[model samples]
Target: MRNHTALTTFILLGLTQDPQLQIFLFIFLFTTYILSITGNLTIITLTIVDLHLKTPMYFFLQNFSFLEISFTTACVPRFLYSISTGDRTISYNACAIQLFFTDLFGVTEFFLLAIMSYDRYVAICKPLHYMTIMNNKVCQNMILCCWTASLVVIVPPLCLGLNLEFCDTNIIDHFLCDANPILKISCSDTWLIEQMVIGSAVLTFITTLLCVALSYIYIIRTITRFPSAQQKKKAFSTCSSHVIVVSITYGSCIFIYVKPSAKEDMTINKSVSVLISSISPMLNPFIYTLRNKQVKQAFNDTVKKLVFLLKK
Candidate 1:
């Protein structure tokens, strides 16, 4: 088959074809996206306003919340609109933009978490030098590197997709402009791009995951060496929460992405995608705040001031 001209618009097959479930999906996703935005915003506000959270860890966290808000915004709103309006057609350019930003945010989130893990490790394993190691300028540079690296890592696959031959088949079998779904519609042999995507996914996910894992290994070992049971508990408590959040995020992603097939089962892939794109971002705020005593105290303090101002 000869290569074909580029198509103008692509129809997203969306999450489902079930007319009966469209309204329900719309409401559920709409509520979830709203909550994701609200929760992440609260975290950001508290982190910025409260002096208690003026450390490097929370500095990183503020950026993390901003990233999560971006991650959720990139896909959920468009997906929700598609579900509600029954208009699944997306311009090729729009799809390309979505693919790039979502992947950029997704990749950066992974690296940020890794850097945060190192932050925790330094904070715990070398409390005397946390500030010296993770100073303001250094922290700023680390964050800059994460965003820059995300852009660097996503360019190749995006360029590949942009130059693809669609052969007039413009229906994407997923909600957003996912790589696998886009590849399936292209007339060109996608073997090289597929390999590149897989390589990139594996490289990004696994390397960050290993960094996180290695940091925690040292953290766990150090905490276990503490002389007092109370000290041991406090140390583990800090890192454990991060580990849990990371585990849930990376675990779900590995299940979905690191596979032989782009999507072995659309239903399973979609379910896992929802976990990554919607549930995880929504849950991160709670995961981070509910477990951290400093954040809780900051929240209480912020509330007290607001209430006092209102009464006056």
Candidate 2:
């Protein structure tokens, strides 16, 4: 972390300049942030306490909920503060830290989702060996690999960003400190850093997406071969929640990061990003709980236990 940049503080322009809009955004974001935290935390708590959820699938779901919480926490609260207090300036180091964490959590999530897909594949395609193959130890190691892989992808570009000289301008277009907006303000040569960022994004996206795609392919093929229609329905139901999440995660990201026309609509991109960080996290818990019988049952059971204790 070298202090080579001339400008130490960058002003974020935020989503809009209207006072009315800012108030609306603040209220909206705060509500969603609270909901996101509560939802993900509920999932985490349920996974921890419910014996019925003591499966490899719920293990990954627990971690995914954690990642969603972490990812949203990285940016949402700060933006909310800025909106309410009318202070949009973030120090250079603070901006860098935010960028690093957001990327770390975001990248790790892609891998985690892929891992979840593989878990589903194993459960459906190779049920007899699922327990042995995806034991607790293996799940823990796979999560560690997700973090390690994310670091490998993000660290190089960030190190290069340290050498960026922000003498030109300090006003960022987006609500939060993100890679592209920061790079746009730098006076130094950003070609290499930009390339590396693109490479990292592509690598994470392609590799994880391929894993998810292949896993589902095999899963679908195996499910189709099952003799009983009831078996097929149950198998698909087990995977539907994960598939919906994967689609939303990948689709929004591809629109923002991989689309050729992304640069043309920065405002739209930022708005879509808000949905990704805030709305998506808030929605995931409901998606899982509503679609999953085991989770709903566990929640009901837990509620009953709490009610019984309260009565005593």
Residue-by-residue lDDT tens digits, candidate 2, 1-312: 244555678899999999999998989999999999999999999999999899999999999999999999998999998998889999878988999999999999999999999999999999999999999999999999999999999999998888777665789899998887777767777778877877788888999999999999999999999999999999999999999999999999877776432234578889988999999999999999999999999999999999999999
- CA error at residue 231 for candidate 1, angstroms: 0.8
TM-score of each: 0.96, 0.97
Model 2: lowest-lDDT 10 consecutive positions: 256-265
**TM match of model 1 to true structure:** 0.96
RMSD, one per candidate, in order: 1.8, 1.5
For model 1, residues 60-161, the per-residue Cα lDDT tens digits are: 999999999999899899998888778899987788889888999999999999999999999989999999999999999999999988888889877877
Local distance difference test, each candidate: 0.86, 0.90
lDDT of model 2 at position 298: 92
lDDT of 2 at 287: 98
